[model samples]
Target: MRQDELWGEDTTQRYDTPGTGMFAPDVVEPAVHRLAELADGGRALEFAIGTGRIAVPLARHGVPVTGIELSQPMIAQLRSKTDEATIPVVVGDMATASAPGPFHLVYLVFNTISNLLTQPEQVECFRNAARHLIPGGRFVIELHVPDLRKLPPGQHAVVFTSGPGYLGVDTYDPLHQHLTSHHFHYTEDGQARLARSPHRYIWPAELDLMGQLAGFELESRHADWKGGEFTAESGSHVSVYRLGPVTAT
Candidate 1:
């Protein structure tokens, strides 16, 4: 699906169900804390800043925040939360859009980089982040690791989440490093609504290479926003790359 099409009116509205998965306090706090600290009292820019989810709170914490978003619906949803003076957003592609910045930190969270859907586009996103940062500034990304391990011999699909209200599954295409997520939302009337989005699953090492190509070096990587050690068993990672000479991993 095109990036803009993936997040329409209903989808953006459904994204912020307070206390649910992504919007839960516990899920949001650690991320804000980590990003705020990384900002080091400097400005921050968020790529694909959907609904101002992380940006608004980070700004309230005193970090100047700006965003680049491709979806007007998502941006509208964000606007509904806070006025333009609070969080200015540019409606354009994260991989190519420019926001006023030499920001100290630039971040893409919640597996948003995958939305680029191709290796070259994802690499361009890294370059774009580098473009917005000051020397030695950091770029952080929160992405899920591919779960090929869960794909048995010939299976191409994995149901990662299943509940009475929702079902989330991913279908993989290893030949092209693509994965399509299908989300099913159930209503009280026994009707199921579906939303599907495509992503390009990337390996951690591959991401590091993209950082290098964009003139960045790996600074640190963690299993989550809380800074847990990243390991083979981890499902997602928060990786920080700096705009300078390579750092020993």
Candidate 2:
């Protein structure tokens, strides 16, 4: 499905999990705190700011926040919580969208960058982030490390999430760095539904190279929002890259 269709109205309605899963205070507060600190009292921009999950709370924390979102349905959901005056959002692709000037922080969380589904688009996303940031500003990305190790020699899929009412699996194309996450949701009535989305999984080293191509220097990488050490066993990372002089040719 296309990106917008994947996050259409039905999906948008189901996206917000207030006080649970990604919306739990423990999962969210630390990220908001860290982002506020990184903003350093300057304006912030969020790429793919879905349903104001972080932007609303962060704005409440006194940092000015703007967003770039492609899904109109998602943006509408966001509007239900806050007005455009409180947090203005431009509707366009994050890889090419333009928002108001020179934000101190530009962030893409929850592996949103991977939605671009191609190397060049991902590179453009880095450049786009750089374009929106002031020199010395920071670009932050939170993404998962591919779980190739979980696959047996010939297996191409891994079950990444399994819970009482849900099952999530990822099928991989190693040669193309592609992934399609399939989610199965079960209703109390015994009904089952499936949703799938495509992504291009990226490695830390390749991400750093993308940053460098957009004139950014690696600042720090942590296992989580709380600044935990990123060890080999870490499944995901929150990476910070600082804007520097443009050198991409």
Over the full model, what C-alpha lDDT does candidate 2 score relative to the true structure?
Answer: 0.94
Measured over all alpha carbons after superposition, the RMSD of each candidate to the real structure, in angstroms, is: 1.1, 2.6
Per-model lDDT: 0.93, 0.94
Kindly provide the TM-score of model 1 when superposed on the true structure, using C-alpha atoms.
0.97
Query: Where does candidate 2 stray beyond 4 Å?
Result: 245-249
What's each prediction's TM-score? 0.97, 0.96
lDDT tens digits by residue: candidate 2, 142-188: 99998799988889999998999999999999999999999999999
Candidate 1: list runs displaced more than 4 Å.
Answer: none
Q: Write the per-residue lDDT of candidate 1 for residues 1-249, one digit (tens) a residue.
A: 577888988788788877778888899999999999999999999999999889989999999999999999999888888999988999899999999988999999999999888899999999999999999999999999999998988999999899889999999999999999999999999998989989999999999999999999999999999999999999999999999985656
Q: What is the lDDT of candidate 1?
A: 0.93
